[model samples]
Target: MIQRHEKQIERIHKWKEDHATLLKRIRKIYIWVIWLMLPVAIFFWLFLPLSRNTVMIWFWSYYALWQVWIISRSKTVMWTHVARFFAAGIWLVGPLCAGLLWSIHYLLADGAASIQEPWSAIILGPIVEEIFKLLPLLLFLFVTGKERQLSLTDYALFGFALGTGFQFMEEVLRSWVSSRESLLGMFISLIYDNTKEWGFAELFPGYFIHGDVIAAGHHVWTGFAALGIGFAVHFRQKLGKWIWLVPLFLLSWAIFDHGAYNSHVNLLTSDIIIEFLHFFTGYGHWYKWLFVLSLFLAVYLDYRTLNQEKKALPLLPHETLLEPVTESIELIKSILQSPKQWAATMLFLRERRAYGFAMALKEREKPRQKIYHHVQLAYHLLGISALLLLSFLAVNSIAVENPYYLAGLFDGLSAWWESLSAFEQISIILTTTLVTALLMLATGGGIISAGFTAIGTGLLAKDTLANSEQIASILRDPKSFFKQLQEDAKEMPPQELMMKLFGLGLDFASRRIPGGKEGIEWLSNLQSKSQQFGKKAKMDGDRGGGGREGNEGTGNIPKKTVTSNKGKTIDVTPTANHSTTTSVPNPAKGTPNSSVDILDKKTGEIKTRRFYGPDGRAVRDVDYTNHGNAKTHPEWPHEHIFKWNSDGTFNR
Candidate 1:
């Protein structure tokens, strides 16, 4: 046996040596990867004609793909997957997107009242673009898993990402091909188009609203489509037949929205008599209300989405365990339960300095790369938002200081406005409102960026302070989470303490992942373990030492029944192992009683409490430790634990 043990140790040592050598080789390879990658990244972003916008286009394009990937996730996603998707998305998205731009050109020249690019871009682009953008998702869904539909949120996110990608490509191409002369020439052309048709305004807000509106429409249309598919797949008996109406509805919605937008012809145009025949009661101007209605309806849909997420949140798996886990799902569910309930809980827990749990849960939910990329996006958005806000401030400041340019702009534009003699008053008001809305959206970016920056910084700070390596490891190896839960939730372990730590990061979990109920099983186990461990300590002396006892001669009589032995003591979770030392409490407070009682009222032989050896086996002596620090409260100087080595390190 000794020879066998020696051989095993030798083999293990050899394996360690080999592993160390492998690690050295891996480091050497990393040096080469750095050399290879840096130049590639730089060149791809600089020298290549398309590379200037590559980061914007490819990054966001991949981001769009990632939305699909996450919703359609068969497994965990990683940076490698993101990179792969970027490469593939760019390859496929480029030509198709180019075609969209050309289609907008021809469609607008054919459909518009005047020859204009931006106006035509706005007028014909959206309707045509929606068709192209919706194709990839539709085909992807059909070929892969027809009936495995997405939730409305994911469907919306995916549609938006796709449209954003298309927009990115369009922007890149526009920037690439644009000339100063072209932009200058388009001013008159664009105005002509806008004068002829009002749809230009709808398309002009393409920076954000373009993707948003189309995503709204697609989300509604395709969302309905997916809902139908899901119904047919999952609950066939009731909804399968009803589901068929989705595509028809999709066609109807597109046609109606398109026709409604196309039907607008200003009263000054050649079609005014036809417009008067149709909209004699001012339907041309009233079309603005449709756009407003559409925007609000989209917002309402989003609200419903959030509420649906909330409803599903509480249903997340929790409490079906021996001890409750400290997953963020529970925390978020609690938050969503009611603003007041969560507010009180947050205040209570935060006041107690129990923030580690939230950090832990955040760490457990999001990995480093996801966090890094998200932070990058946030910073980019911050930059854009800040610029917009500053621009507005500048414009306002300029108006107050100079006044001449504002006068000139208002005069010139107002003259153009005055040209619409019959439509002057209503057009001015509508255009002004449109301008105001544009400013608001641009400025709103600042608000969104600030929100993200604040949340990210706070969460990151909490994670750092909380020592997130433990939780990070769990996220890295999800399969190990259950094992960690079991290990952390043992009776003699710091189950509750770990639970508190995990609780701090709950918000992070709330925003990410599905199936809160699945995650809470481990927490339930931890909770159960806490109760057992707490009960064990409470029942050490047969549960009789419920209150303070002053006498030196301890009562030997065992209790007749199990009872609550609640004491005014802070039982800490284990911090370090091996040393049987614990932090002490106030000497003024009564000592905790270690007693045991019979399980039932009808008892057998009297049971006595016994201490165990370091090996957790039978032993006689109950070891006492004395560890203390100068920071200890002066009033409780003598009560502080003082187990220290010669070096002054607290020997646990």
Candidate 2:
């Protein structure tokens, strides 16, 4: 019966795993579906004679459904999924508050509508929008209990969804409230009405003016930034305990970025920059470039926060790609090294887990592999960025040509739009949108192909050489590399011979120079004086008095001082608890030692001692906490060791 119960438990666990995998695949399918059907959404949303509000409502509803589907698959219970849907309803409440604020502002002001437009965009909009966007997040926090339970990525997505919903309604409200003609309609009208001798500048302005905010823009970016700040606050224990200033700093940055984007301050600030561009490139209105730059910064910062969180803890639902790599390395390390070395290495690996142990191992492997990894990262970054930039430049260049080829294309579009019936308009728009997306993709793919060809040729040549004798020179032969690895495992070593060369002359000069020795002596004296002060203070406190000049101690206090290397002095002080504390200097040549010692005063024996090197790293530690006088049994003594970067920062 017990065996049967165990089998049933195993079956349930297996079922859960299968269900999770199925959900992951389903989520991927849903994402792909959304992307593939985006052009369909764009076409219908633009061309259908349905009320703009209705179209927006449908769009939001579809997105909300996707969000609910995601939450359902989050390994949460049915009640949690249902709660998510209720939390999402808070976005509906947001716009109503925004509407109330707008109405109040309109009724209370004597300003013209033109004045109010910029005022609303710059001031009123960000305030109302950010406040309302935060409401759903606050509600999520209140409902979720401890904020630390949810991953930072999850909260970021929550804020993004909230901003998305608000952005949709806000955009619809803009379209509904505006008295001006639709941007696309005006552009089409301009093409037909001014068919003869049209000004390219007039056509350019229409393209810049848009009623709907794209999902990739300010709203989502700001929301992620704001939530990142909140994540830093709530996960301070995991992030960095007592670092309250970090979240406040992030919050300040988010508010400023949102305000700048909404107020079009990027454009305002770029006028001089644009004029400079005009002076050289003969075209300027660099506001879009500024906007894109700001968006990139926000996105990059959010990515950094997510990266830090990923380092601190495993991301939910998906294991880190490095986990398998690390385990594989450990399995290999175990096979290669002696049991003692293997144990030490395992301890070292655990200590450095937060610092990406797998990546570090790859770094220390064959020099060729390190080069390949670096080149791979560089090529990927350059290839993606350059490809996207070139594709967009190609598209935008064609659109904004001096003769206005895009305007001429719109002229043709006007004729087609007029010729088509309502149902036909939807079909044509869908086809055109898909064709445009395909063209852009094809252009990007072509550029990527050219880039990869060049990059591949160089990499292939490098790899060929790396596999042969050429890389031996870079890593200084295999024997030396293996020796270096062996030596690194033994202890926290000093600067390499080449690195020590620079400091060699300096140390020699310090030894020979008159003032250098005097300065060291002066620094040593200063340490002694500080110790004397501390002793006096201790005596005064013990006697319950407050006088710098205390009675001379013959038997009352014990004091001992040892100075070496004409460097910093280490004071070993005795306490009433029969313990002594001391600092040990580095005995290694060309390495300054900074260490402390604790001893059993009565035995005149070392109880515990920690040895630190020139880089201020505790290279070795010995604690006799459980040391026994009986020689019959041995104690398992150990030291927590660390490796250092070239610049003196410890690995973990």
Candidate 3:
């Protein structure tokens, strides 16, 4: 049995190595593709007479990317990983799930018309779409082998990508179906047809109302579900066996929200609730408010989780320390004075973030090895591929009867190209070549030399050019830059610096905009209130014995107080023997709210840990000291678990 276990571990390790290699190669290829496609995307954006639908698509796409960027600013996950997942949502999950939905409707419904009927849209649609949208997240967790290492923000980002992709595809299909255009015609219309009929209402459907569009959408819904999944996985051990139900509950809630929107059912039936939502959202979009609220709550939870996780991460070497304002100023200076340095600085920052995340992951507890069968992986891949192929065929079969054929469209284009005079063709080629070359050079060269050449000839701002050389010097040496950043951080209080920057921004805005001074005053009051609230919360936490002390004991171990769910405080103190013991405030008869953590003397590694509930039962117990007892515990470093009852009690 031991030999078999060893073999399994060996296989798991081998698979992980191979998977890492494959991912690295894929990342390299993706980077190349992004660079190569940049010019093409720009050319199309500039020259194409985009239809209303296409414009809306571009708008939503930009909005989604912007949201991802803003939310992931302080996150541990790499943007590239999120981008790959986003692409998957667009190209893979979106089409495959869509095809599946089409197939289901065709199989069950009376005809093509029945697919959009009330019953299907209200009931069947929500279940199928929600489940399919979640599949990518589940698959990602299974395949990555670093599920435990992932943060809540990471899961949310993945879900957002999937949801965005699905939404885009849905909008495209709606346009195609409504217009009764041929596949080829639909493609052409997306680029060449200039139609003004499609407005914000048509693009977003039920979301736009009262001259405003709610930020909540399909991405928000999926992100909420994904955050629940993250919570369930992260707290499974601490929260007991019942914690796994969180994801299911969230998923069900998402389905209900989707169904309610489709059926035009107002879940918020109370007048008070309706009034509150309308006043805040500036519209009577109850479903959108519910989704937005849920997403916001989930984000708040993610932020809390991030606070805890960040404490475990070591500070990165040579990390940029400039405040947001200073950083922006430096970036602008780099772009204007030296584009090459700007490019290098950007690359350096990207690498630095990636390295920080890598270090954090390395510091985490070693994960349990799981044997992943190649056959099982192959089956999953084949199943997904088959579904995609079948869906494509099914959708194509439905569209084939349309009048606008792709063959004739391509033929016309070919003929047009052939008929062009040599001079015209040369001009066209030269224009395209020049545009592409200029774009490549501008982006590649760190700064557009032509644009700078023009700007350099004119009067430049003295303030902007004041520290140009200094910025250039720092950009050249990342180590020096980071070292200076650390010094700056040490010299100035972060809050003070933040306040100074905010004041500068407010002053600048007040001078330029109407009622800006009043807005600034209101914002200041809000900030003051928020700070007071934060201070109160911290004080409460400390009073309740939920805060850790900074004072270090022997071997740099810190004494801390932990507050349990039952309002019990447990004081933990490190001993001379390298073991820590938790002392409960008071014992109720036989019940004890105590715990013990045995640590290795040399490495300070946890050898064994045990936690007792208020009911005197062992709620959780980890045994790394008994790995030799394979008969009892086949898995090394396994924990003895207790089930949590619905009424806040544990069942052993």
TM-score of each: 0.32, 0.30, 0.44
Model 2 Cα lDDT, one tens digit per residue, 83-193? 232234334645455455546555875423322343444434444445445555555444433243433333444555555444443443333333234587566645532
- Per-residue error at 372 for model 1, in Å? 41
Q: Model 1, range 162-199, lDDT digits (tens) per residue?
A: 44444444443343333222454466445534321113
State residue 62's C-alpha deviation in candidate 2, in Å.
7.1
Write down the worst ten-residue block by lDDT for model 3.
453-462
**C-alpha RMSD (angstroms) for model 1:** 23.5
Model 1, stretches more than 4 Å misplaced? 1-94, 97-128, 183-186, 189-237, 240-242, 255-652
- In candidate 2, position 504 carries an lDDT of 30
Best by lDDT: 3
Give me the runs in candidate 2 sitting further than 4 Å from their true place.
1-47, 51-93, 111-115, 173-219, 238-255, 265-652
Q: Please give the lDDT score for candidate 1.
A: 0.32
Q: Is candidate 1 or candidate 2 better by lDDT?
A: 2
* Candidate 2 deviation (Cα RMSD): 24.6
With candidate 3 superimposed using the best TM-score fit, by how many Å does residue 572's alpha carbon deviate from the native?
31
Candidate 3: stretches off by over 4 Å: 1-52, 72-74, 111-113, 176-216, 265-312, 315-652
